[model samples]
Target: MVNESSVLFEKQGHIGILTLNRPPANAYHLEMLNCFNTSLRQAINDPEINAIIVDSSSEKFFCAGADIKVFEANTTEENAKMISQARENMALIENCEKVVIAVINGHCLGGGLEIALACDIRFAAKHQYLIGLPEINLGLIPGNGGSQRLTRLIGVSNAIQMLSTGDSISAQEAYRMGLINQLFDSEELMPAAVALASKLGQGPALAIAATKKAVYGGALLPMAEALELEKRLVDTLYDTQDGQEGFRAFVEKRPAQFTGK
Candidate 1:
């Protein structure tokens, strides 16, 4: 395990696990945010690690959002800088070649929900945990990517309702709204996430990365442009070793041993 201030990094097989380690609430402070981004870059650079899971060590709260005290003390300019930094980190997660999953073990609110939204997939605990963007309660709006990402994930009506009221939703409600990919009992959450990540890690890496790029990049374009983007990505994958290996394995009636080449 690698410890850096409030974040803990660990590798299990081909999956890199990042735990938000600040006790109780696991609120994001400037130092913790910096450590999170640095650790994420390290994980991304490690070729052996093909997938990542972001979770919290705290049992009661995945993350309570930013440290309230810090926000209260900072000037508008300072807060803007901090928000920009946070959004940059979120973009790193969104654009990662390998799949990144947010394993929400407990309460996920405000910036916490923003972080989860940035991930490619999210799995939450099924124990009635609260998850939402409650910045309105503080007489502020979501400073991170919450406004945009939330609307994209769920619909505008749902996003607006949640944001306007500052009301948190249950884990099941989040799943129903497509905010989270799946829900599991508290004890089963990490294991389930690891199992899913391990399967993806062992699959064709190049194809997986291309698919992610195609889906995310194409989502913002018109239908015709999106189809063209998909075609380009599919054509580009034909030159990859893993692509050939997958075809050969299918013909040979054997499991492909993907080396991520």
Candidate 2:
């Protein structure tokens, strides 16, 4: 296990586990945000880790968002710098070759929701949990990618309503809006997240990574261009060792063992 002042990084089999470890609310301070970025880079560079799961040590908060005290104390210049760093941190999560899953154990709002938005998938607990982009309530807007990402994930109408109203949604509502992939009982959340990560960890890593790249990269392109991009990615995957192994294993009537090469 690798421990930072604000986050805990550990590996379970082939899955890397990153737990947000700040106190009562798990709010992001500048130092915690920097530590989080460093921890994420460490996980990305670890060859043994195939997939990652981001969770929280807090029982009541996946993350309450930026620390109010810190925000209040910062000057305009300092706030700008912090916002830039937060965006960079989220970008790291988005661009990582390996899949990253956010396991939301409790409340997720504002910057917290933005963090989950960057992940490839999000799984949340069924009880005592709320998720939203509520920056409007603070007389500010989401400085992170919440505005863009939420609109892309759910649609502009829903995203506007959520962000403008500064209201939290229940787990069921979040799932319905496609903000979260799935929900589980509070007691079963972590185990379920681990199971899903393990399943992805054992898949053809090259193909999986390619799929992520194609989807996210193509989402903003024209339809014709997106299709072309998809074709290119698929062709690229065809040359991978795991690609050949997959076909061979199919013909041999055996499970494919992918080495991520």
Candidate 3:
């Protein structure tokens, strides 16, 4: 679907899966990012898809970050465009209406971790893999929404330490640090991630989208403003068909069949 490329997209029921397919390590460049963005847009535009998962085809390297070759012998204009594309891709993940989950079954470093951070949730394998923003080691820093999102997700001080040090931490440490939502056995990673996505996919899509908007968007505003935003979102949901269906189902002691209306 993407010129026989570095990413693959497939649908399973209500879930959309995007798999990084570059061999050895899914180190992405401009072309790969373009394909990845296009696939994500396809999922986002699909009305039938309620949840999406970002995964990989490799077992040893989730993604080794940007291909270093992109930085070699490239003009300033080309370099800027590359970084801009990476930033836009990250924003695409964060601003997507459908719930997104990143399943990290291998080492996730630098830009890879940044991509995971943009997702609503992350689950990693329990294998002895490392995860971090190791850009400092290369005498550069995360330019793909990593610095901003990482700080917001994991706190300023911790993010600063991790970025400044540019060192990869163990999967166990990443879990304890809240870098990942949970850790699964290597064999269970994708299945567990898919299980959660499937459950979410069955939920009321509009209300779930509203809640996600409230939490992520409201968190950026002041306290009073945030409360207002939440209240507004809740108020809107109450009038939706699914909301009424839920109420009637409860009164009738029957399961609600939401059509994501």
Residues 61-87 of candidate 3 have per-residue lDDT tens digits of 888888888777678898788789889
Clashing pairs in 2: none
lDDT of each: 0.91, 0.91, 0.89
Any runs in candidate 1 off by more than 4 Å, and if so which? none
Candidate 3 displacement at residue 29 in angstroms:
0.5
Q: Look at candidate 3 and give me any clashing residue pairs.
A: none
Weakest ten-residue segment in model 1 by summed lDDT: 76-85
TM-score, per-candidate, Cα-based: 0.97, 0.98, 0.96
Shift of residue 70 alpha carbon in model 3, Å: 2.1
Candidate 1 residue lDDT tens string, 28-101: 87888899998999899999999999999998999998988987798988777778778988999999899999
Model 3 CA deviation exceeding 4 Å by range? 1-4
Candidate order by lDDT, decreasing, is 1, 2, 3
Better of 1 and 3 by TM-score: 1
Error of 3 at 244 (Å): 0.6
Candidate 2 lDDT for residue 58: 92
lDDT of 3 at 225: 98
